[model samples]
Target: MSISDAKVDVVKDLKSEDAKWVKIQKVFYKDPNGKARDWEFASRQTRVEGSELDGVGILAILEKPTGPEVLLQRQFRPPVNGVVIEFPAGLLDKNETAEQCAERELLEETGYIGKAFSSSPIAFCDPGFCNTNLKLVQVSIDLNDPRNVNPKQQLEDGEFIENFTVPLKEFPEKLEALVSAGYILDARVQNIAAGIIVARKYSL
Candidate 1:
């Protein structure tokens, strides 16, 4: 089934015990003036010991004669109740580094096997609402590679993602078009487009 047909029937609060990936808690802390305060926030429950990262986002770049094409996907996000465009991403497996997780997730979600070279520092997503942190990994995909020709996705059960590519230079314009077409852009996806705009404007 396509994400366009996905629907949510009801929404309800879930207890921390019933949650498999995340939990909510109110943390009490002392402010600068010794004032006691409590902050309610959500955090992941599956972090590997000694690891500060929760997940990795793959910034896959396909080498094309025209220009670099960024791999992106569209999926139904229950929180937003809409088909959202986002980069291929997933939580880290046991003992998996950010680069390793990025490569695995990229192949699973998009069917393109690529090599990860660089990664961003741990970046928090909606720090005010959750303690989820992830790294943006840059992966290089050589379309001329024999394996990349007609690659097939290996999504897990319940995953329904549609992958597509947009030229890097035209990503911002594509984002505008997608927004006008009633598709939600994930915050990280939007930020990448904004970064492209700023970089071009400043000749970076």
Candidate 2:
């Protein structure tokens, strides 16, 4: 799990007045099996004008005939080349709390207004390259209400999704299949799913 000879050599010093997704020069140093390998990478860095806010959202939903029901969305992400089942997530608007973002995304994506049981700070999705971070929110649903099963409204211009429910015990299998199919390439999501599995197993 350790990357050897990991070094960043700045090629160009970027300015803050640049537009989003500004390119900065970077040289990557890699020592593979004691051999020196140098690769130049054009790193992108941008100045986010707005204040940084925690992006909190729900994940690892579950549902059953009698037990607690959870919500999940099958997201059609073009970047990944297909649909991957995942929980509803969104960035917190400026001045908004992580809990508020979690509730908003849950309702907007899956049309469910459930309560967040536990939430995590906005952790780095990938520290090596991207500055994107996500706040992990754990939510418990109220299945007694019929509105929880309603169709969700897709807000993103081209967001195509399918909402579905499954028992908590079956989440790992679905996640595994998504990984096998190359839809879930983000390691952060995998790590979140592992934590979810531990949570559900202990709850039951």
Displacement of the residue 57 alpha carbon in candidate 2, Å: 3.5
The weakest ten consecutive residues by lDDT in model 2 span: 1-10
Q: Write the per-residue lDDT of candidate 1 for residues 108-187, one digit (tens) a residue.
A: 88889899999999999999999999999999999999999998999899899999999998999999999999999999
Candidate 2 lDDT, tens digit per residue, 1-204?
211122344446556346365344455565757766655433334222374543654763544466654566666554445555666777667666777778777777767767777877657765555556677888766666687666467467745556766555565676687668755434545665687888887994
lDDT of each: 0.93, 0.61
Superposed by TM-score, candidate 2 places the C-alpha of residue 89 at a distance from the truth, in angstroms, of 0.9
Q: Which regions of candidate 2 fall more than 4 Å away from where they truly are?
A: 1-51, 60-65, 178-188, 196-204
Cα lDDT, model 1, residue 198: 93
Task: Give per-model CA RMSD.
Answer: 1.0, 10.0
